[model samples]
Target: MEFHLVSLILAFKKDTVGIPLAEISYFWGQMGAGKTSIARLINYCLGGSIELSPALQNEFVSAKLTVRLKKGPLEIERGRDSNTVVVKWGEKEDAIQASIPARDANGELIPGTGIENLSDLLFWMSALVPPRVRKSKTKADSETKRLSMRNLLWYCYLDQDEIDSSFFYLDSRDPFSRLASLDVVRYVTGYHDEHILDLEAQLDSLRGERMAMLASIESLARVLRDVGVESEPEIHARVSRLRETADAIFREISQQRNASVSERTTVHALDGLTAQAQALNVRISGLDDAISEVLHARDRDTRHLHEIETLSIKFRRSQSARAVLAGVQFHSCPRCAQILPERPKDNCIVCGQAEIDDIPDSTEEALLQRDIKQRSEELKEIIRRHDAAIIQLRREREELDIKKRRVERERNEASARFDSAYLSSMLNKERERSALQQQADSLAAMARFPQILDSQRQKVGAIQAQEAKLRGKLKDAREAAEKDATNINTLGQLFLDCLVRSEVPGITSSDTVEIPTNSYLPEIHSPGIADNTVVSFATLSSGGKKTLFKCCFAVAMHRLATKVGAPLPGMLIIDSPMKNISERENREQFEGFYNMIYELKANELSATQFILIDKEYTAPVEELDLSLFSRHMKPNDPSKPLDPETAPLIPYYLGN
Candidate 1:
């Protein structure tokens, strides 16, 4: 987005140093020339950390970097050891000042911009929407984090210390930073564009909602099971059976009411009610027995499930231990203190059996875990069923007790009445019929549960279908992102070209360089004498090679970003491109590297700004741009001292 460094001003206690930047700025001198400090100060002014040398800690008062952003010239200034930076933008007359803190939680406000921190302010100035990414890779619904200025600077600046030690923080020890670094690469390459971000957000939300729905269904099924029904069909069937039994009872009661009953008939009716009451008591006792039995079974299954969980944990620990000790070869038994016999190949060291006979520990562990999972699920199902049975049995017992109470009340009323026996029998039968009708009404209410469960199932099914459709769309969109493929391909080829031009040892034109999409890191595939071998940045042998390798890839990325109009800054600040290399021994390789850089600048990157700090200078030819600024600082050569106007970065202090 065209972030060009115009100037850097370092204010000291005694004097201020103003260094003007150009299309290509080279600063090279002795070890303590303070060249690196210039780059660090520029980074510090732009909201980055600085490792202050003694000179800076003592005499350096503040540092300021003026840059030409897309909007206009911007000034960012930071005082030594300060936690905040001051940014001034707009015209020289009515420029706005923003007191930006390192963190937003510190609560400094940026004027005329609706941004909380420096990162957002930069993005706002660029007139680009800040991109959001998931904070965690493992969680689909993790909070989204916005890409910051520091992320973009990873590509723009290659510091001296990390030039050889790190590759864009891709292998950072801190997990969050590592992920952010990967996201930056993805963003630059168009893999993490706004469209993909939106689709991913939608997918995460839908997946979370769908999980909740499935959990609700499981809970609802358990509730239905407690009422002696597993499905809609089962619920309907049971309801129908209960209603039919109640209807039969009603018919018997109706017949008794219409029958002409003599004294003998009254005695028979009384005996029949007594008999019904006794039968209810017996049935209630049976229900109690069933409930108790099911409770015991449920408790037993719960204990078994607990045991399985414990064993599963122990099994996993054992597998881990085995994996850790698999490479060890013992000379003597630890317990017996006896020299061990020579073991045959493919044989167990402990058991002295063929390894083939003893199942692979990983395979065994997998099978054990699977078996434990299966058994645990089975136990859970059994316990759930037992609980349901217990609930149903208790409910039946309660209903029978109510019926027995009513029967006894009817018999007592009949005995106390002085009315005719036939009238007493008819009145008792009518009360019995009313009780049966009430029982039938209760059954009708129970039928509604099945309908409720059916509605919930429909909702879950619909959500699942929607989830499938969204997943398919996401997959298709990811596969169809042609821009990402083109950018990656271009970056890889550029990296290879840089490597070949620099004459990096052990690599030839035939050796293919690839930036794998999965890791977003470079890989070198070389055809070996016997088999193909793959090498990465970490495996590059010499420190000089590693440094050049990283710098080359960064240059290639900058070129690609410029070509595609990506949102990377237009300036590159490299501290030490030859920190470990010896120009006297490798003149051809040394000159070739700078030659490639000069060729690109003269042609494709004429507008880009380059700031390089090294111990040796590689002067650009006069045929190249005349705006090249090169500074050589020597410590005044105390043996043959000359002018006091050498203009060392901090002239008063010479400490490294």
Candidate 2:
């Protein structure tokens, strides 16, 4: 993906300074002239924390950087000592701006980007899927975390201080950073491809499912043991015996009812009691339906009221946003990256047309507020009425229940008056039948436990089968990727070539650098020195040699990315590359380093953009398409003090 900076704007308390960048820009100046400070400001705007000098801390107001991505131009603005960056994207008239927290994102999605933070937004704008690596390397089934933009920046941005002190953070004291650095190497080298990542995600999910199923099986077994049902067959036999006894009791009760019919002399009285009970039952059912209707109406009204309340809240928030953002104007078309023209008085700042008031009138706002209030009040009143109706219906139903019981008692009394002995026998038989039927029902319910257990076992077997198939597929995908060893070898060869051109001491074209897929660190083998003795970045003692060594590798990485269409941003920023190396003593090495960098920009990396900050300027013989911006800044030295106008960055303060 292409990423190039258009300009860096520093808003100081005294005045604002705009530094325009080109395809190749150079910021060279005297000591303490804020040459390195320019790079630090850019990094800070992009979500890096740097120790600001006292001069800047007191005078600086804010920093803004406009960057052109593949999609369009995005402007990022960060205030002094602020943790959030305000990003403006999209077109001029239809622009969108959101505040994104740099740190402590806590997995929040930025509005309109569908991404969690600035890092994810950058990857999304570049049309690249953020790569994922295992959080814990020791566990194969560990969850994965995304390799963020900050991780990739380790390769792109080389600070003035860290250039000689750090080697791509590979030797970082923090274990997480060290591991992430290794993963970044693996990613750009093509070892962590998309297909392999997808397979890993699938396998992780399957492992979770398998573990859950195993837990469920253990829990079900424990429950069965507690109930004394040792086996499914034993429970089935017990249920069968209970059913047989219940059937015999049912038959005996049926014979007793048949014999009692002849002794029932109060048949007419019994019929009257049945009719009255039927009337009461119908009245109770009517009351139940009335209560249900009232409840349904109340529930529907309550939902409507909730929706209106939510709408009212959103409306108020919208008004607040308008008031806060009033009179904000855009100076550039974010989509096309063009300067905006001045509009007529009272014209729309966005479209440069006549202003059309979109804010609601006071009368309309009042009407809306009144409508919401009235609707809420009406709903409350309806709900109160429904509650009263429900209570009334329940009271009526209770009265009918009393009448129903009285009819039953009267029928029983009339039967006893006719034949007390027969009634007593029938009542005893009915009670016995009820007890037997209840036992049968309970046994039938328990019989379902064995069936449920069998179903659960089947589910577990199915999941295991699926898991086995997925694991096989994942293994095959990984094996296929590991067999293709071309990417890592190519990267290693590029690193060696860059080292030769940069002219690091004790390194030549004959040396070989090996970056194995397992550990993505360069192991140099120089035949002129010691072929058997492996020389790596850690073995390099000279600070100058280390700075050039790290820079050379970074250039080679960008070159490789350009050739293979890797997802590295098309920009590089190097600050104080010659901090430890003096140009007068190391002329050959210094010139060779700049020569190599310019040649790459002119040829293989022609599309790449570079920002170099140093004490001196080096130009190539050949003229490039886009003129390189070389700004020389002078500090306000007290002895032969320079004017504030000479200082291009921060001019007012004296402290470094």
Candidate 3:
């Protein structure tokens, strides 16, 4: 399905700066849908001539595109009084304009470029184009060639009024100066000579300012701390004498306390006793459970055997006789569709005793009574034997349970004896451990005395603290000096300047860069125009600074596209390039700006596709005429039929 064949989502994708390609994709929808917004996004993606606010994010990543250009032979002056045509491989890269010879089928050059239609001309030029190279081809004049021209593929912007009325013109304050003047893909892409230099200069300025600010902060902090700290040696000597006297007194008191205390070994005996008790508990539980289970099983089996025995007596007393009922197997079943196979010789195969030839009725009661008597006798005998066996089994189970209980009782007595013996031995071991612990404690006390030499410790601590403080002060001073040059304020100002230049009128970023900061320059102003000016989205003009942002974005993208080969996958998003252009003249100027979006950088791609978002105007927006997307706008829909009301606007009748 065509992406735009259905619903028209008025919204476009958003980005901080540059016409976002994602935003423009929705541009081709019906009237009231954003079509021109898409164009602006394309322009931005290609890094066209728009100026992005410095405040807006400008990230540089690679892009790719298929080659498409106006096919034409370049006209270059040949021999004296003659001209020729030649094919040049590279697009306008470094140099926006170039002159080349126009050539025919033969090697002989032509007088002027013969092709007209740009799209078709591009194809022809592509065919004749040569490999890109830095050096220019030398003419065979025999005299060493003096003058030669070379062509370059461009990812930059150019500023020309007739070329494209840009977003820069909409601003009243003119936040961007060099930017407003910038009007080409070459200029925006940084391919222009001044771009890289400007970036470097700004970065340098920021670094310098940052350092200066840091130094100033450090100087103030250092000057504030006036404490005259004492030397480590003097403080350490006084503290050491006091600590030595305290330690001697503490040792004497601890020794006296130790001599008076005695150790207890009873806890060990208690632990051993507990373990022995737990072992016996497990044995007692298992034996008791096993005995109960055996008794229950024996009782249940015996009861069942008794009941069956009673039934056996009734079966033995009953009489028995052969019983049969007669029925014929029909070849075809009347009730169902099924057919039965032929039966054996008997008339009724189901009951052999009866015949279908003379259908037998019910069986004799006497016969059934006789058969019951015989069955009852057999049942009684079987029951008698089963009952006897069950009784024997129960007797055995009871005997086994009694034996198990006796064994468990004996085991418990043995466990109690073992517990007492283990307890005695555990007490002896505990006493030994206490004795060893006392010896180790005596040795440890002596070892700690040397380690606790108070004089040395006090001296070390004092010196370390003094050294730390001095080092801290020195570090602060050095850092302050470095920071003075590269302070946050300095960097902020530089970044702000860049942003201020990139700012589109009314498009104040939720993002802000604090600038006008400097130790020397205390009265640094805010980086941007007043907050009052940065109003609602509705207040901002579409094709103004916001739209210009896309052009600059395109220039950047073009550079990246050339680096790689083929069509670019990255999308360009433009909200509304013509958002601000409501009046006819302004709209047309923006449309021209739209054309300006597709310059050298755009030409490198397989196709510079764009999504255009357009707002339907009450009048026939003449400014929109300059844009290529104007062709895509559809006539009024079936629902919104054109009639006497909308007729004056359309050149021809489009509705009933």
lDDT of 1: 0.78
TM-scores of the models, in the order given: 0.66, 0.64, 0.22
- In candidate 2, stretches whose alpha carbon ends up further than 4 angstroms from where it belongs are 103-105, 108-114, 204-468, 624-626, 638-648
Best model number under TM-score: 1
- Put down candidate 1 lDDT per residue, 1-656, tens digits, no spaces: 87899999989999888999988898888887688888888888888888888777888899888988888888888898887888889986888887787435333265565577777777777787677777877753455667788888999899999999989989788887888888888888887766887877776676677678778778877766655566667656666765676677677666766765442345545666678888888888888888888888888889989998998898778767777877888778868978888888887776678875554566776787788899999998898888767777887787688788989888777667765655665676667656656655664566776677778778867866776787677667767774448889888888888988888887788878778776778988876643455667888889999988998989888888888777888888888888889887877667878888887888877767889888777877778764788888765444454544444677666454
Each candidate's clash count:
0, 0, 114
Query: Could you tell me the C-alpha RMSD of candidate 2 in Å?
Result: 25.5
Worst 10 residues of 1 by lDDT: 102-111
The weakest ten consecutive residues by lDDT in model 2 span: 263-272
Residue 629 of model 1: what lDDT? 84
lDDT of candidate 2 over 157-269, digit per residue (tens):
99988898877888788888889989887777676788877876776676677678778877876665544454667676766776677677677656666765664433355
lDDT of 3: 0.35
Q: Which stretches of candidate 1 lie over 4 Å from their true place?
A: 92-94, 103-114, 138-143, 197-308, 319-331, 334-338, 341-472, 482-484, 526-531, 636-645, 654-656
lDDT of 2: 0.78
